[model samples]
Target: MTGNRTHLLLYAVEDLRKPLIQQLLAYPQINYSFADTPSELLFQIAQQPPLLIFCRTTERSRVPTSTPLIILCPTHEYHPAQFIHEPAIVDIVAETDLMRLPFIVLRELREEHAIVRETHRLRTLVEHTPYGVIEVEIDSRQIRWSNKAMHHLFGYSAGEMQNLHIEDLHPNDIHTTIINAFQQMSSGDETPLIHITCLHQDRSTFFAILHRAELTGTGKRSSSSFLPMLLVNTKVSAPCKSMPTGSNSPCARLIKDCTISISAVVGQL
Candidate 1:
């Protein structure tokens, strides 16, 4: 569980002179980082961002998405969400409600804790499952984690998958499409259906369907993970040969029979 009174990043020019800055710093619930200019604030934002921020409406353009901004402007004329490109914002204290900032901070802390707890629970559920699971980072298409079954399906040992990127495991054209789908899944887009071919230790390939969704982690940081249920139906319907070919090697004949069985099953899908 995370601390309810976690620090929030804020950017202000000559922050020491701002009256609200002193109060915000003193308040245990809100901890802010003060920057002198938009450029400085952006630099700090790339390094560390707060869950919620306090800044003037004119400074809205400077806020980062990681730190959802709360405008400290006098007028409630603009919805802070619109003026700023941040995903969400809670306009608790405008200039008119200066006195109420402390109370709102306390309330926001409690509500924020609840949201964090729920997200943790969901991630726990996904992580604890017996099914082979993987969280693929969208931008880089890297394998974040792999479950027990996934470890078995691929020859890679426990920590070995971490060394391999998704594109390296999956072949060419499918790599780009899968990476894009994973990103969309994280952004609340429709769940991506992936039919990925995983290579086994002996260099044999097997297919599995990937169920993907965006996991909203702590502080709204997002990553894409999936539950892959291995489909093992190779034995039941192998290709039947009325007449056996004498010329082919035993290994060649066996592989040919397995391929035919896989084709029939895929046709049913």
Candidate 2:
């Protein structure tokens, strides 16, 4: 989805910078857009931010919040800190180092493009997969992420399911068993596929195969404190009738519990 536009922006004079423009054109990664005047440059900055910028420093110019700005100026006349302090300008180069512009721009943009690409890939997988996939906080079991299948399966809209919990959908009779299962999963045990009855948003119950894996701190949560895991549940059959209170039916035996790890689901992401 992100490959529709070019990545580079330059604000400079067209006629005088012929030699410099040729050097920039040599790199195939560069998708260059030009803005000759201060007003045009400012408009581009506000409307379409680029990976990198090469322009003459003017009183009207303000660097973008994140895009790397490389000012064109005489080395001796430049005050490096003034532009660097703006929180956007990344470098300043004199005319002598014009050859380095493309390399520096490509290096600056590589990481940004990779992150965008990966995020798009993951979003596509989650939305298209048949199972109801969710990521919940290990300690709270609060739902952090849920795909379309999850919301549809539980009879909740995307907005309604935000900040909801797994317990919110579990039948009250199975609460104690589910809690114990979560405790075991959090302690680092691999849980097998367990069949269970879960409550929908309308208070109806359905049978689903729940799979759990313990995700350590990495990928989505790159902190020591936040250990969120994946929960993948596939609806195996139609909605089942809720059994009478304290009845030992065939459904009771199917009510096992589950948990998961974020790093383990990289392919899913």
Candidate 3:
């Protein structure tokens, strides 16, 4: 097998039929190994874990709980309800439907690849974005992650920011207000775009607009969910003297521009 091909492990007490073996081998993108016993299977996994595992229903218990699996059952014996508690089982197929195996594997691989690509694309966007973004653990109110732009905006290194609480980024005078806002968000209240003062590492303060959104799946807030805040600095030097009479101040213009830009970005996300 070449280094780039997907590796699969097949565990069965009895040999798979010749047709099934040939079906899997026909896919050039896949390379596979067979093991009749649990110990041999585990040894192979220890050396180099396969991307996915194919196992007989009888041998399902022997497969590692962390690995994804496709279970093969005797014809007319497949029961979907029986594997409801087993999160590791991706799909269950009857022995007679072995022809579907290759298609299933390819479908899974394609989906996995798409997820990887999307994750990479998002990470790159975050790293390069001009807007400061920070992710806070909803339950603990601790700073969990931030991008380079975020670090630069607050004048703190990535290491220092990791140890600071979410409150540390704001001035002490408004800590109470910030806490109240967070409580409301946690309680599922509709929060308007927040305008607040933010503190930098040097203790200098600046005006900013804060936009908050949940970072996890839809539903009630959970411990695993994150509160991601997009910070846009609206601080500007005294209104530009070059402006025409009664025109909006630079700060107002900047805030309006930021609000529109952030709304568009959030919509895409």
Candidate 4:
């Protein structure tokens, strides 16, 4: 199989009709291979994973976890309930609808390509941005996700930061302030941009501007819960001439503009 063409695997397809064969062969960009037995199919899959698999409904249980599959069911045996809960099954078609295979394959390929492009775009933006981004669980206060810029700002390697809590990034004197801010934000109160002292992995202190926004979960908590997340953005700044007495203090001037800019960027993500 050539790298330029999308490869498809056909497993245990008995009595292949001429029209079905012709329909598959019609696409120049698609290359296909057949596997007669379960062992042969698994061996071929392990050797070179196919873009999609075309398998008989009876053999659907043999399909690997997370591998995209299109079930070929006989017209009389078709039932939507069997495949509805399976994430891997993209679509099901009756044996008489063999000609529609190429169209389904092409559509799935386009969607997969589009997702790859969008993921790359977001990763590029996150890595190149000036501010260090950190995502923390609001309840546990643990660090969940962070960007490369965060590693640079905090003097911590990627693995070192994973086990840290939000309080660990600040000095002992400011733990109360940080906890109060978190509580206020959780209660749906507006948290204005503020200047604070932050600690590096080596325990050195520096002045930085901090902003956070709540990220709510879209799906149920059982499957995956991104809810109650605090998306924190920080940028190192020069020492303030005078400490911030309040939100309207002189030190606020240093980070006033960042409030709107960071919020806009996070909103887009």
Candidate 5:
């Protein structure tokens, strides 16, 4: 991991004013970069953020950033709750703690690196998977994630389904069935792949092979939502042939007028 040298950013008006800057540079494993002004510091952080930032608190306003920050101030002025409570603000330190700073920086850096590695690995796995994986909130029916295949089969572009409720994708006749399946799964039932009529963005419909799996380890993020589940859908196929398209059936007329205007009032999409 040390093959790529760790970058440490120090932002202060004067380099000689902070002895810790020179002290940190003495460590061969870390490379140092300096930003003389707040704007310069923000630019560097945005372009290529360092492993840790030791910023001398400035009078100029700063925006919330994802980079881990160590706000340097006098011990009397330091307030952990008020200053370091934000997600990006990792810790507040006084000048007196200069000798112990390197160890704290190293520990936080290692932890952050590990998290990035794991997230990247999971993202790679999700993107390349053969099946279209989807995560949804049971109560709100909000979609959390959808892979490329899901978008293609549903006739939606990337992120189009994010704010859409899962119920909107299904015909009205199957809403009860879908909800029942989730309810059964919540009651500890082993879910099997079921066929359902799913609507495409073009208002066309196809039968989808759907498999629901409860997300047990989702933790508190979805706990209040009652249940969180993963819906894996395979390739879209022809609609069910169970419905007869004979001349006497209403569906036959609906199919004839399919290109004109298809309505869900008669039957499932």
Candidate 6:
């Protein structure tokens, strides 16, 4: 599920300037300002840092981390590699609807959640459990599930978390990175995913990850997918990989590498 619009900050060549600005402003949620040069783009991206960015095809970058870059190119500019590659880039090469952009932005945040009416036993188990549990929807901004531990771990009350957009938990400074991840998920460059972070209630930061699930549940509401878990580190990077990849344990599978203490991992001899 996408957003009404992802707030944007633009960096484009002088040629496509006017029309692109006009079209973007029409969507109320999609806020933006301009950066005529890539250098200017980085400065604005860091300062006012937006959800996504749009630039021309002829543009190049020294920006290391990937951000969603909408390529505005001339008719003849469609090269095979350019159009088909990792990190999907949208084009103004042809006339079309950009309705997909907002939707994709909304989807990327892992913000969608619809409260699932669970059996009493299941609901009780979720609440009483010690692990920080989270039930989220992958397609909408709605946060439909969580336990006390989940809310406690982050700085949000159950009501606050429910009302705010999932992206609120993430620092706005890195929103461009988030939007990039969202676009990748939208374009098949990535799969259902989660990463680790820690967040405090007064709005502090910590380690947590998007809960991992391999199946799609029956969507009771729209296209949103039910996500049932989001694990966080009580301690940062006890090596974020809690278990080694390809491990036999289900818990280990969710985590990349199993790391116990020097004594505990190997057993005290």
Which consecutive 10 residues in model 2 have the weakest lDDT in total?
Answer: 253-262
TM-score of each candidate structure, all chains considered together: 0.59, 0.51, 0.64, 0.60, 0.51, 0.38
What is the lDDT of every predicted structure here? 0.54, 0.62, 0.72, 0.68, 0.60, 0.50
Those runs of model 5 whose alpha carbons end farther than 4 Å from true positions after fitting are 1-6, 13-18, 124-131, 134-206, 209-230, 234-269
Location of the lowest summed lDDT over 10 successive residues in candidate 1 = 228-237
- Give the alpha carbon lDDT tens digit for every residue of 119-205 in model 2: 677656555555576665767866777778788788887777765766676789987776667666556544532456788888877
The most accurate candidate by lDDT is: 3
lDDT per residue for candidate 4 within 61-117, as digits (tens), equals: 888876899999999988868888888999898888888898988888787776576
Q: Which has the better TM-score: candidate 3, or candidate 5?
A: 3
Evaluated at residue 143, the lDDT of candidate 6 is 64
RMSD of 5: 13.6
lDDT of 5 by residue, 48-74 (tens): 768777676662236337567777777
lDDT of 5 at 195: 47
How high is the lDDT of residue 74 in model 3? 88
- lDDT string for model 1 (58-133, tens) is 7766665556556676555644555444455666456656656656666767788777776566545545444455
lDDT of 3: 0.72
> Per-residue lDDT of 55-83 in model 6, one digit per residue for the tens?
55556353324566555454465454656
Number of the candidate with higher TM-score, 3 or 4: 3
Selected candidate, larger lDDT, 2 vs 3 = 3
| TM-score between model 4 and native | 0.60
Off by over 4 Å in 1: 1-6, 13-26, 75-88, 167-197, 204-207, 213-269
Residue 261 lDDT in candidate 6: 22
